[model samples]
Target: MAGKELHVTDIFLAVQVEAIVAREGAIMAVEKGFSNYVIESDSLQIITALRTTTTDRSVIGLIVEDTKSLMARVTGEVTTHIRRTANIVADCLAQFGRNIGANLTWFEEPPNFIIHLLFEDCN
Candidate 1:
């Protein structure tokens, strides 16, 4: 597992933060020599922008650009516009980030708190 604790003040929008997170995950995936992976996010806007592969001057646009660059360096498909209800595990992890402090964490196994949620997702 890999994640980051981002402060609210530095993030522009939910989609922007999501993009940043996706980019970070992709970079890690590349580092670990992953391929043909599926990157899922519940933010439709970010996903759509990513799929479009357009670069703009806005804050989120820069993030989108960065995300695309990272993804391009790796290999995978980005799954977007996932409904919140369909993404309970990711949702739970995002909530967990709130109290976890401001640091990036990487682990070899799933966080213990969300095992049930992951099971539920699989089922």
Candidate 2:
């Protein structure tokens, strides 16, 4: 899933938005029948929140809880925080999505635009 689209009435902090997106990504992975997966985010705060077992009563409490529930259902789920420089492909795709103002998902293979970045990331 890509692009920024939140059908909410109130303004959310950046960390909250990142948490929401992480939750959505987890949901998609589970729906696609992925039993093992690694979720990486540039937001260390969100990653830390997900790693914790305690209940979060903050503004993003519900989103974090739901994400944890999804993670529990997976067989081997890993969540980590990486610097944005280490995730150039995701960053580029996110920028592309924002430019187009639409949400997009690509399975099996990514779009042509980020192919080189993906290769570079792997190497």
Candidate 3:
């Protein structure tokens, strides 16, 4: 959902659960001076748009464009992942954003609550 309220370009990859990670997330993470991030629901839709080369552009086109722009400035390969279960961490972030009234910002990194609640048990 790339809009004035929440920009998809703000999201970045903090961790990779599987062999693949999202290109958009990877691009955002490595971007310079982008500290805070806000991820929205319907993440799969954004990823799908980026992966596909079809000209059937929708609202997701903004997301794909922002991702490509960010990727050019960032370093490293973008990873792609399968399975909803594998995306629990990002899923939780989306939930948090919804649970809150408006956008939530993190300074230089994701909040401690997220790290403790989600990434502490990384295996």
Clashes of each: 0, 0, 2
For residues 24-98, could you state the per-residue lDDT of candidate 1 as single tens digits?
777677777767546677777777777884575666777678767777876665555778788777776677676
Model 1, residue 40: what's the lDDT?
A: 75
User: Residue-wise lDDT of candidate 3 within 36-101, one digit each (tens)?
Assistant: 333332345554554566642554455465555555454443424356777676666655554555
Off by over 4 Å in 2: 1-11, 116-123
Ranking by lDDT: 2, 1, 3
lDDT tens digits, residue span 1-123, model 2: 332333433545878768878888788778888878688899988899999999988889899999999988889889989998897776766555556655666676556766665666433
The RMSD (Cα, Å) of candidate 1 is 3.8
Q: Which runs in model 3 stand beyond 4 Å of their true positions?
A: 1-45, 52-56, 107-110, 119-123
lDDT by candidate, in order shown: 0.68, 0.75, 0.45
Clash pairs for candidate 1: none
Models, CA RMSD each: 3.8, 4.4, 9.1
Best by TM-score: 2
TM-scores for all predictions = 0.76, 0.80, 0.49
In angstroms, how far off is 93's CA in candidate 2? 2.0
Indicate whether candidate 1 or candidate 3 has the larger TM-score.
1
Q: Which candidate is the best by lDDT?
A: 2
| lDDT head-to-head 1 vs 2, winner | 2
